[model samples]
Target chain A: MDLIRKTNTSYLIFLAFLMPIMIGADYFLIQYLFNSEVEETLLHEEERIQYHLAKDGDLPISNYLHEVTPIDKGFELNPKFKDTLFFEAYTDKNIPYRLYSFSSSIDQKPVKITLRHMLPEIEELIWFFFIATFAILLLLVIGLYLIHQEIYRSTWHPFFKNLSMLKQYDFSKMESTQLNSSGIREFEEINQVIITLMEQVRKDFQNLKEFNENISHEIQTPLAIIRNKVVHLLESKNLNKNELRQVESIYQETNKLSKIGKALTLISRIENQEFKRLDRVDVSTLVENILNNMEEIINFKNLDISTELQPMTIECDHILADILFTNLINNAIQHNKEGGWIKIRLSTDTFEITNCGDVSEVKPDKLFDRFQKGSSSKDSLGLGLAINQKICEIYEFTLNYESKEEIHTFSLRFKA
Target chain B: MKVLVIEDNLELLQDIKSFLEEEGNICEIAPTYKSAMGKIGFFPYDILVVDITLPDGNGLDIIREVKKENIDIGIIIISAKNSVGDKIHGLEIGADDYLTKPFYLAELNARIKALYRRKAYQGSREIYFNEIKIKPDSYEIFINDKPMNLTKKEFDIIHFFVVNKHRLLTKEAIAEHLWGDHIEMADSYKFIYTHLANLRKKIGELGGKNYIQSIYSVGYKFTDQEWT
Candidate 1:
């Protein structure tokens, strides 16, 4: 259903429908003209026959095309034309003829005269006319169609180009959606409208992004205040056990609130693409460093850890790279069962981490959404996978998750 | 140790100053960026804990001001922003350390002490808690004048507890201090409990009294107090 094909199909249908109508019109026109010319010749021949009879008061010599004959008649006759088929002794088949018949008085007596013209070539003439007219009209239509196709293709070239440009446009990556103007006025108008709309959208998006970032930052101060106040309360020796528990709960929640705020800020920062420092980061080393740091936690869980790593280096933001792997490794460690196993494999093309955790009911894709954790781990912030997904999207890597029974696996494929 | 805390928020400033003063360090306070600038070079404070976002001006300018004065002062930036770029920028401009906001005061105390020691001692920075001695520069701790076989994580927990002595340190605070961003939103009490138990056992085996008090299910407090 492209523009070109749609128009071309309609044109072809029009031509197909026009074919029979044009042929029928041609047949009738040619027949009318042919009949008129034959009628004129027949009338002239009849007049010559009458003249000869009147001049000598005798019958004229008979011929196949013209015949002078006498007939008993009670009334005068008017000339009439009729088509008939005559049998020829030599050909042994009927040949079509146009006959003119009339009665005339020869020697003051009534006589009948008939004039016939053979029309053996009328079928050939119709076919010839049909082929000739059809060929010419078809040539005209096809020529026009081809020329229009070229014109339409060139005319809509910029429209399609603009479409492709729109497909690749991203608000986070670019500040403007400037489009090239097509020479045509319609396409130019469309491009201008898109550019104007994108400019407005960029402004609004910037305002919202800055607004969120500011809120995230400003809220941290109050959270810090609350945390410090709670700590002070916890330090009070006169406070009873219940009061200590209450203060400790407050402290813990404040920590969680701060963590959630920081995580949200990190996601926004990634969305804003604020981390622009790209370097050749060694993935293997980052993994090793994170593993070394989490060794105590892993050991405490009694998780059997194994790694198969090939030295992999990729162009990435150093901090983002560190956060990405650290989050993934923490996820693997956090969700594991006691005395579970963790298997990690890393290569230049792919990185995978599989751990023995509770059976997951959430799908792999939805697990990457914010506040969507694989299990009902109430303390988990559920933003770790979301952040990981955002990082992978930024770096053009493919991150996937799968669970088989109790084994949860996360795999990341580096773009080749 | 004389420390100047430059923070716009009076409430946070008072808490930090009082806490530090209780730790036996002389604490001076500035409630605004202008007040901080007025007091920058007037006294050679050993440490200047500056909050980056102030009502009047940027705290980084204060660090620049301190550096321009050419005084041997330790700078620690406390900001709500956790951006590595900002952290690196703060560190590159002569700040000794960068601590994110909403952080535990205990963690800040530890950083301040570590920075103060590194500034004052100039190569021999060891902290003694009763019979327990810790050399932070080289991850080693000695109990009762003999080195104790302690893991890195055990050493970190004990060191954190020692620096923030007599203060209530929550399990979340310790995890965040030790594992940092790596621990994230996961409840890291298990990690803290495992390492702490090992640290207590090791210190007790080395003939050191149990100075660490597990405050019920809430947190732990390190002080010279017997179990009640």
Candidate 2:
């Protein structure tokens, strides 16, 4: 906005300086032409008077012409007298002697005239030219002001108004005002810059929100474990050999608490952009590791397994990818019914896992939301899908889930 | 009933183990995801006490794996997260119970018992402890096959005590639980004392021994004193 205002001011100044100079130049040119025309008339009259003086013996008229010459010179000599006066004396030959005085003190060189009767008419025309010149200059000033106003309306005003809208731009509202029409190149460039800045700010705000939510969710898990264990220890009074069992539960809850802390720190690191180590990761090996890790769970549930595979490798942050898959595959199996089937498939650059589970309670769009899970299971943090989604976004991979007839499917398609 | 505890914290895990061991139940421990997976695979437990955050992986993953094997093991998800969404997710994934951290160990025991009851009885609805049999749905108490007439408050108090037997229930929690949401504005807890006294007297009149014991400056514990 400040820039816009400055440009407008400079443009107005340019117009302010330019108009008067142009008007003054035109005024001087017209005045010069009028003065020259008056001098030419006076000279023509002086020639005719000299011709009459030679043709007839009219020394009296000639002498009078000579006397008016001194008055004409005095008109030039007297600096205060601004106007020129001309008087005509007509001889018998109808020739005229004219005194053309410009309020100078030099009167000896008064010019004679032949057409002396037209002196008043010529003088009126010169006076009219002066008046017309002044009028034209006034009109030019008014005309330039109007033109300047139109320029502001068409260019600077709209641009500045559009820029003012940017002052109110807020990402929380997620609404942007439309830019006004840019009639000139400078305004267009400014508008583009403002729009780009606004978009960047909005994106940063969204990232901040996501980061905060993830941090809180990660922290809560450990806190919950500690709380539950403490409550259990304080409340239970049974001493019938279940004491060892109670100790084990408390120890388990404590361990969970610590793990939650670690996870929170890990998530914060990711949000804060601390870790950026990347390598060419073997997609097959990563998937195999996660599956092997979950082997005990697979056997315990007696779930039938099926797979399709093609050798594939990809470059990515291996640790995060491993965590992402571990969470997702674990969730799929945990939420399945007894004797359910889990299918794992891998390709050159894509991997997918599907399992039999109840997904009726989950909304598809909200599946990736932290702590959002479908009915068929309890005791989940719902962080798996969220983590998976985050990893996908970071790696530029595409992750999606589909549920149909109790079969929940998760697919991770790597970008080629 | 057998319960499996899979948590990594040694202190909290030890506390829970001792408490549950005192309750006449065997609890197996698996501190890491690998060990937890092994226990879930090789062992048969009536209830699995699991946490969401685990060392090798998340406890949720273990829950999911066990669930897929179709093991009829009852699961109680113990999480530190208190998000409504987390609670819903755990329950949705077939966990019979979800308890947030900072919860009482006694509550977990109750939930474990509830899960067992739900799994075994399937709403046939009776909680039996020695000679005392309580019908939860009907709120009736039968001692030595004889129905004992008890007041509403007395019956409720006795039922709560029995459900959370061998557990110390804080007085404040008891008051709030009994009064529901209105507990916040309660001026005094004298009424809880009156109800407890009445309940004990009635049970004593019926030739039943007192099971409720007061812990100094804390709360009440209900357990078979003679057996303990």
Candidate 3:
């Protein structure tokens, strides 16, 4: 799957196809050359026999030329000769021979002469050359593959380093990323592009953060002004009943508006990673404090409360953790029925709060969404669970909600 | 007590000025950082209520200038930003208290009174409404020189009422004052009625005059005079 393996496999396939063709060509070439040399020697032997018969009027005895017979009559008038191969069984191993047969005259008489040469030595030489060529080809392929592997590793080292750096980059830190120059043009180009892109992204993030802060500040001041004015009007002793009702309605609506504004701002801030200070926050202590603070509300409704908390600690921003716990507990208390029971269980890695309430009409999937209020509660801004979910996301914690059998449960699972 | 309020919004400035003035404190208003700095340079005041973001300059600079003069002026930063950084920064630079915007005027009044008490009086600052006396630090109350049993929240409500005497305290404001952030998620402000009733009952049982009057559908007003 990797580059080196793919290249090596292809190269091996090519060698597999090329090796046999090379060996076959060498075999044929060595066979042809050896056959020609045997033919030459046979022809020279024939010529010498003829020369001896012509000079001394008798044929010279030669070991290479055998089966020399003088044809007295009915000898073939044709003097054609041909070279052929035959098996010689006189030795322990049957060996092949190159034999040339021809018709000639000895002492003015026609004679048939045949010369044969064994080819076992040339066969052995061909085998040796075939094996040596195969070995060389194999060594060449292996050496090239190893060289390629080394080059690949060294060449891609900088690319892999840059990849890991990109993976570990955290936008919240806004620290500029430094990439080592690999001296490779393509890799350097990639690093430059990434650096420019990240810089732009950081700039955009900063601008959006500032804009959110400014908008929140701008909106809150006017809301405060309207609220204070309404307060002053409500304080007057000279207002009619209708006017008083109007003032009270205005004041209440303004309060809701203020809450929504604050909740939105808090969500944006969390998303922006503004709360970055982390500390060892004890979960049990925070839940206890919140429960204690809500005691009055529980008493007002006469609801039964129970807590099963184990000592648990997580590293997180303290204020955000407080808000997270506060929202969960507050939701449980606010949604519970009068005289209902509430239960909280905290373990080493999880916290769950369940309360007896009417079966919620809001869908489970839409529970953590902003402005998703229960059908019965008209006063809720519906931002409580949303804020809690955002805080959980910031900490990589899991927040889940379920409602069944007239009971509502919210759970948080912290990552260790 | 004399106070200087530096705020950009005219209506809010007027409201704060009128409310504090009605509470029997001499209140002056500066609509910008420049005027506020000019006023502080020439005048001595008991408290400086500054909004952090001003049109001319930062209210923090005003705080710096006031502190540089060593005038012993109590500073309460009232800003719209609920940012923890800003609050910590302001407090670190000697701001006595920080109140986020959209706060109730009664809450503001209580914070100002508390700040003034802490700055002007080292300890032993007791608030009196007719014969009812409240020791805020010790969370104790006396009616006609006799001690009365009061819960912490009861003590706080009465303390708030006594501090902002004769002012209408909305139920929402009282809720926020009692339960700061939790009040937002509260289903209703009806719980305040229980505390209010218990406070009135305890005060009445102590042979004290009933000064807490509910203004029918509006809120409660605390005063020394009897109302029908």
Candidate 4:
């Protein structure tokens, strides 16, 4: 879960528990205070009755608040506070009261006097307080929740905005990832760190690309000089048959070195996104041209060529398309066996090629790596499929390779 | 043919000057951009061979300077950078041809001769080698005034052979020449053998001597001498 959601959910759970607990604690305290205050009011009523008997020398009539009882001579009665129920004639209901009673001689006769005060209906009061507490807690919980949600959103807004910026950062465009100051110290510091880190990454990537170009040139020049010198040596009259063969071997290696350097540089260029020119290239025509160019080579192995093309076009760097198709078709022909039959089908959405070649031992996942070859051949540079894969990735085309027994197939599906 | 080679590498310059000079062309060398400019300012030449990377400045700048002279010169740019952008830019700026580095000297010689033929104001468009008349433009060949039938590749092999006559042409160079730089033709040694055999047979049937010789199974040599 995200930070805001997680924090909000936990806070809601705590409030759910706190609301009931706070209300219960307030109920018990109010009930206890009401009982003690009622007992004190009953005692004050008893004191006023005693004062009237002593001062006025007269007794008040019996009622619900004062209950009078005649007693025998020398009656021993407990005079203290007690709880009792009294019936009212007018109301005709028994009501609970706090009572204070004592056996005292009134009007020179033995009599028992009791003072009562109606206790408040605690159930009704409790019900009222319950509803009141419920309303107050409900309001507080809702108010606090909304205020917390507002704070959460405002505080995390810039963080998420810059988080997306980090996700969308592009090294090829050379755009700076300068995060805005969000007025939050931790977030601002993290943004600064990310910007610094991205700048460093861009610098390293640029330096590596430059290094690739420089190395290719640095190696190509000497290779050229060596190749030219070998050409001169091959023309020498003093060289015999073996010398000429050795010199030719040296010459071929030099050519391969030159090609490897160039191929590596091309890969680097693609990764550096240097080829930006986009043109609408006809896939059908491009495939036709490469196959036609390789007709002689195809014939060398006595391979059959069958093609069915429907006009298909794509927008990409035309050179990359040419290279992609050339490499794919060339791989089909190069790895093909004698008397092999090749089949090619192209449509507006998909292109597929199948050829029967030697059973490949190269792993499927390793097929598109540079220098990974199905067969060990000194003449093959083994960079064809890798370059094709790179081009396909750039165009968002899906390239699939499958081989069963000696039949290998490659299919490319273009993005719609 | 008069040619001026502008390159910073002294050894490569010497190599090119000697190869073209041996081919009966008057060749001059300039080792740096300043020297190249100084030479081209005073003298006029039929061709200028330039390397793009120079010690002082880019060789492309020299081509620009020579184009300013308007001397009817054929310029071939040589560079170690095998970039499509560089190639298109070079051609756009008046370069007659673009040759990437680490090239066979024989290939260089063939291109230089082809450029010379293309630049000549009044000359035979056909190259002659001992009655083997090659029309480079139409990809046709004639022996004893008889038009010979040849495939496009066969015609190219003959054309390449005639241009770099009496020289050792490796199988690698011929494959690279037949198939322009990109196609992986490493196993094309068999293709070259088949084509060369058919080419030699066609010429032999036309009453022309077989002048192409195999050198120790590594390369081929074309000469004026008759094969036994």
Among incorrect, acceptable, medium and high, the docking class of model 1 is medium
DockQ of each: 0.63, 0.10, 0.50, 0.54
Top-lDDT candidate index: 1
Give the per-residue lDDT digits (tens) of candidate 4, residues A1-416.
Answer: 97767877787788788867866787788767876786667666667767888888677453435778989888798878777777878889877787878877778777788777677666777778778987987787778778877877798788888888878877765666677678999987888788888899999977887888889767977888898888777766778777877988898788888888877877877776767888999999999888777777887789999999999799899989888888888888888887898899998999999999888878988899988886645688878788788788778998999999999999999998
Give the fraction of reference interface contacts each candidate recovers. 0.62, 0.22, 0.56, 0.54
lDDT ranking, best first: 1, 3, 4, 2
Q: Clashing residue pairs, candidate 4?
A: none
Query: Residue B33 in candidate 4 has what lDDT?
Result: 92
- In the order shown, the chain A TM-scores of the predictions are 0.87, 0.46, 0.70, 0.77
Lowest-scoring 10 consecutive residues by lDDT in candidate 1 chain A?
Answer: A59-68
CA lDDT of A43 in candidate 3? 83
Name the candidate that leads on TM-score.
1
Restricted to chain B, the TM-score per model reads 0.94, 0.84, 0.95, 0.95
TM-score of 3: 0.76
lDDT of 2 by residue, A273-352 (tens): 44365767776677676666455446546678787767677776666766666676667667766688888899876788
Q: Where does candidate 4 stray beyond 4 Å?
A: A16-149, A237-249, A358-362, A392-409, A413-415, B121-124, B143-149, B201-210, B224-228
Task: Name the runs in model 1 displaced over 4 angstroms.
Answer: A40-64, A75-78, A86-95, A120-130, A182-200, B182-187, B226-228
Model 1 C-alpha lDDT versus the unseen true structure = 0.85
lDDT (CA) for every model shown?
Answer: 0.85, 0.64, 0.83, 0.83
